[model samples]
Target: MEFHSNSTVFHCDVVGSDAHTTVLLQEAVDALAVKPGGTYVDGTFGRGGHSRLILERLEKTGRLIALDRDPAALAVAQAIDDRRFSVSHNSFSKIQEVLGQFHVDRVDGILLDLGVSSPQLEDASRGFSFRLDGLLDMRMDMSQGQTAAEWLASASEAHLEEVLRNYGEERFAKQIARAIVAARARQPMVTTHQLATLVATIVHARGRENKQNPATRTFQAIRIYLNQELENLSLALPQCVQMLNPGGRLVVISFHSLEDRIVKRFMRQLASSDGMPRKLPLRANEVRLLSRQTLRLVGKAIRPGANEVESNPRARSAVMRVAERINRT
Candidate 1:
């Protein structure tokens, strides 16, 4: 089946026995330019795919700190008994704090692989998959925060429409929001199937030709919003930059356009020269001096190959961007 054509169909079949095939795994680690004795941070630490590879490249003196907001992921990280590696149950947004606790101020490289992990998606109780009949909870850290069901139960129709439009980019956001409100009036939406059914019914009525599930966008938007995924990414990017040593690398693997856009824009903004008036009376050398940038874009954005995507449809939308810190006087 052409699972990549539809987000729902793609995710539904990969179940209990399946493992997350880290997209662009070697590419991301190689971009880090790992030094055997250097310090590195795996900011997302989703199942230790990248972390284990990093450890392999690290020498006895090399250190790796892995962080994740999800407790389940942290539990898996705890099994690593390496003296050079440590796991923290914290979001990457707190990278600075995590470093402080370890008495470290800078790292040689930092990698953040964004989006939901395979374990989270396949575990029906997490409510990350639309195909799963589970509670509507979508928190990356299930220990805290409001579940999707709780948020949807009280969000205004206008807010719902806005989330669907802006976060999900759903063309039928208004219709879906209206349908959700109407349906909720009859009863609370407490399960994944209920919400998915509601959205599919509304989208199906529109007679769209796309094979993608109608609920895909809505589910994505809710998960993003509830987890403050974009907000956390925004917060973490600057910290990653600040925590890097001169020549340090920042590698980000984003799974969707929204995440990729933010990563692209942030890296570009840092790489760009300071904006000066075109008519400034300074000499060319002065202009160049004033335009010193903090970051250097390492390379072009990368995508998974057809073979990788064929084996793991979830990698279809993956994009990896790399940047290096420029030494400042």
Candidate 2:
């Protein structure tokens, strides 16, 4: 379990064999329109799913620089021995800085596969899934940041309610937050089972609309809040755009509605020129320049097909968006 990411590269045999199937794997890489000698970025190198396929498409001259917050993912990324491929242990939000570290000013393409990976969810030790019981620690990057358990222990009931309401979109946030406060007063909420069972009892009595565990929203809320998932996505999107070469692609596959909204709005806004009409006489080139449109939308948002969803239910919620950087100059 102790996978140190330093001067050594450990070849993990099971890294690619994990149960977590990369959702929209082919679709994502294809959207990149990989050029043989172009450089690319895989913002979230979860289990090296996209990274492996991307490397396959690249020629020896093509370079791919990947970034991930998870230590386990960094270890898995090391398994790739190609000289053209390199990975940095960091969040995608720091993509600009990561590029600096590699002495890369621009890239031909960038792919960001957001949300909790299957390995992170399946590994109970990581505490992503409410269905499985483990430590309440839900830090995406185990190396740093406050654990979910620690945050829950100190967070005010009001703060917890706000997180549940905003991040989870849970309707019963207030009641659940109040109950957590009451329960924690008697005993600290330290484990996944404790929090799950507590939320379930509260939700089961009031609402029974879905088959999913009643604690599902609370768990998601806590994970997203503690890990700053939405915040990171907001920060990374602009950097992804800034780092891409003209005619390069930016592909993002988001699993959460909030994440998808940010991607959708950002892409749409960039692809449009805000419909700015010239009040004064201006040439077509000048109008185009004044418009400030930086990207062209690729097809429409893509979702996993029914067959793929059937095989991997997690893929059901995936939404993939693509846009190509336009030559503004």
**Which regions in candidate 1 have their CA more than 4 angstroms from the true location?**
1-18, 274-292
lDDT of 1 by residue, 125-236 (tens): 9999999999999999988899999999899999999998888999999999999899999999999999999888888899875878789999999999999999999999
lDDT (CA) for every model shown?
Answer: 0.87, 0.87
Q: lDDT tens string, model 2, 234-313?
A: 99998888888999999999988888999999999898764555566877886876567888999999999999999999
lDDT of 2 at 38: 96
Shift of residue 78 alpha carbon in model 1, Å: 0.1
Model 2 Cα shift for residue 127 (angstroms): 0.9
Separate clash counts for every candidate: 0, 0
